[model samples]
Target: MTSLTASESATLERAADAPMLAQVEQWAAVNSGTGNLAGLRTVAGLLADAFAALPGEVRLVAPDSVENVDAAGHVKTIQRGDHLHLRVRPEAPVQLLLTGHMDTVFAADHPFQSLRWLEDGVLNGPGTADMKAGISVILAALGALEASPFAARVGYDVMINSDEETGSHASAALIAELAQGKTAALTYEPALPDGTLAGARPGSGNFSILIHGRSAHAGRNPEEGRNALIAAADLALRLNALKSAELKVNPAKIDGGGPNNVVPDQAILRVNMRPSTPDAMAAAETALRDAVAAVSHEHDVHCHLHGNFNRPPKPLDPAATRLFELVRDCGAALGLPPIGWNATGGVCDGNNIAACGIPVVDTMGPRGGAIHSSDEFLIVDSLAERAQLSALTMMRIAERGTV
Candidate 1:
């Protein structure tokens, strides 16, 4: 394998510290929450401009757009008629895919849409660490590659899905299509605070359980009432009890109840589950069915559950292990720690891409903490470093021609 020489290494260090911060600052200012259609278009415009500047042909895949949620509760594309694809030198055998999402956990009306700086180098903002910064990294890395001598060895496709924050319902097909013949994929999810990547991720699914029962007045005929809320409570306990080493089930929210004078007739429970493997997922589903069946039988109320797996688990394969090695070497050359990874129960767009048989490193973005909360922040230094690492890794893979 070829390595970056002394001069190349110096160039990489400078590239990592490039003026990419300004670009990130600008992009972070835009709130591209998945449910925000205008925001999606706004970010899409920026991406279009960037891709247009590159020596490639860019096309919009989604012809029309709508709003929807994926199983993961990330803001997701409800209906997708189009998507954007940037293609350069497609005839090249060493084609790579670089994917990311523009949506964040924040909503259009979310107060957290504003950006701020924390102590030292942490910059807090909605979607900053989750990924707006990662987009900037891609641009910067591409900029560097455009100037590098080995640019000719690489051909790439960049896709920024509008609905990744959600389960990527709209973009799932597009991601699969793009990965069909690619050598590898690089996803720009935020790295861990310590700069570790994700080696494997458990499959995730979202479920909504609804309960129905006849209502009756508490004072007039309490015994005549069949309480749906009671049945829901029973189901929730049963679901929660299913948690173990292989599966985690959470009945997260409950909605619907009436005045004390009447027995509640309807209830809704929202649950989320993550399983380490496909078999674990099946077990969880069976357990859920059993719980609902038992509750319905005892309470004489109707129960319904909706939703299933959005993205399957991304297990590390030989191809992924090879990609990880390349990334580790790049990190070491950049004076960072050895590239390391751990399995996570969390799901991302990488899961979607991997489901298509494309080996990928999902958390290749910035390093930060407290994502999806008020305390979320981005490690400013990670902006340049991760971007440079990604650019170098892509160039290296292109030269190696995908094992």
Candidate 2:
């Protein structure tokens, strides 16, 4: 085992003493799913109160307005809960961004709401690893950092948003705003169960294409009516065909359809696209517009598209590689395994942070797996392990000026 310095040992001890498991249980018990506004509110308040323990100003920023395209092809406004932002030592020489999300994929009405021991050292529940436990990790690591002498050398901003599970639509601007002018960033998205990190994530775009056409009784005027459902089906197929090595496509659903007796007049196609690079992302959007245009002209229907690429592909640029090297060095100093990373399909606020041109090692949380399912679990012993890793990493960055 690598020997730790006196300060490192003491700081890690403080981080280890955080009530992470207890906090996870408390938060996982609350169903703060993206669509559950009330639940998001409750959890955001709880997080604000907890993070307030740090030396900083804690504020709950309201989510920006989000629009949804209905089955009837109408765009309507949707509500989301506030996001928690905490600022500490803002004027310090070394500034950092630390981020996580309060939202989970499990909804308030979801049945996978109870926490249970899956084994001696494993606990299963919603948001246990993705990422209430991650939030706990952030709190613990910062608490330790604040106690150490190195605290004076570093400044940080913590953002726990309410809508990450849904592509961070309501909080995208906030992520970009906080990411600006940071020395480095650490996002507490859980690591792989074996402790490997995610690197070079692909960008994601979600869109709802509303199609409208003339309606008529199927038997009486089938030829006279322009079927919106058929046009939507054509659009879905066209969108799917746009898939390639750089871009992956999924036409997930069509929101509108009526009686078999009539030619349906309105349908909203929900599709998602993932592009591995910025060029791919741009080309994908252009191909999409072309497909939509072809479908509209061929089927004689009106199509309205709504959405943008919420998360841009995060490439391992030179700056990002340097940050990863720093984190790996910190892990080595702790006598942990040689930390390494690989590209993942999953996207998070890390993508947004990376887009701001700051170096970031996003998967700094504990070893956990089966996220977004009833089987989600966080390794009990990993709480202290990861917090220590985070605390030391930040301390080292503070000791120096950059990653």
Candidate 3:
């Protein structure tokens, strides 16, 4: 059903012929979790070598330093793995940004380490669907693009970051930098199990609230101490109550409480907030401040809040809508069923790209299901299917000059 010129068909056939399954199997074997520095470095090298075949200047960019609050209520610098970046034909008139993450939720020592054959054509493994396949798809599509006749007229930047699972704090700046002056962006986060794309994404904010109180002996001077643990627990409850129709709050963990005989002197509360829109994000922040003030006053303690909403809400504006339409048309041209999208609460690098005023279609990867769990898998055949879709979409964009 996909009608194309002689040159277009040849280029796309090459893309579909890539050894994507082999590539994904190899990449998924390595544990490149956000906290796995050594593994990440190895995967980054492999990706760099693979991307080098795409007519570009390939390099590994060091991640920006990020900070975090430890369970001891002390701020510490967090080290992250480097990202693989490739810029091709920057001087070309049409520029685009393509992004993917090399990190997964599984740690280096996580038990979900080996790939297993769940059934024919379904391989269960960590990062198989949640993204190793996505990275392979990017390479296949770009490789085809380089071989196409329209290659000289189009340019694109490819970024495979190493810290997406834990929120991509280290690579956020790099994502923004690459998004500037691009016609549109395509992020390789996996499509839904049924192959539907993810449209608008909720903004995510993480916070570490520290509670300081006077420590006093239990029985002897219990009344003299302002229990920090109590205050932290109360704050968590108050934060949860702030959730609305457009905002969801989750108080994930609380750290720092010891020696039952002594009143706790300090405690740290970690919470997550997701807002569906920019206005919702702002309102959530204001409500958070108010809740913190009330808790601090009631418990007679000093409260210090750190962190802000890093990933802003990605709503479908006019430009984003146009990009989605183009992708849908490309899918139609590829003989794929009707392409549609729905908003999801999960966040990814696409949120960061959308914040830069660029149109982005995230979830342009192979169809799969149950990511982040040992059951994660890639719908083996979709690898080539999605690559052809992406290749055709880029070809159209290059020919049309815009989304």
Task: Please report the candidate that would top lDDT against the real structure.
Answer: 3
What are the runs in model 2 whose C-alpha is more than 4 Å off? 1-3
- In model 2, state the lDDT of residue 134: 92
Report, for every candidate in turn, its global Cα lDDT versus the true structure.
0.80, 0.92, 0.93
Where model 1 places Cα greater than 4 Å from the true spot, the runs are: 1-3, 6-14, 63-83
Error of 1 at 147 (Å): 3.7
lDDT per residue (tens digit) for residues 1-403 in model 3: 3477788889889999998999999999999999999999989988988887888799999999999999988899999999999999999999999999999999988999999998998889999998999999999999999899999999999999999998989999999999999999999999987789999999999999999998999889999999999999999999898888899999999997789899998999999999999999999999999989998899999999999999999999999999999888888877888899999999999999999999999999999999999889889989999999899989989999999
Residue lDDT tens for model 2, 1-403: 2567899999999999999999999998998989998898889889988998999899999899998877667788989989999999889999999999999998878899899999998999999999999999999999999999999999999999988988888899998999889999999999999899999999999999988888898998888888998999999999999889999999999988799988988888999999999999999999999999999999999998898898999999999998888788888888888899999998999999999999998899888999988999999899999999999989988987888
Worst window of 10 by summed lDDT in candidate 2? 1-10
* Per-residue lDDT value at 72 in model 2: 67
TM-scores of all predicted structures? 0.89, 0.97, 0.98
Top candidate, metric TM-score: 3
User: How many clashes would you count in candidate 1?
Assistant: 13
Sorted by TM-score (best first), the order is 3, 2, 1
Lowest-scoring 10 consecutive residues by lDDT in candidate 1?
66-75
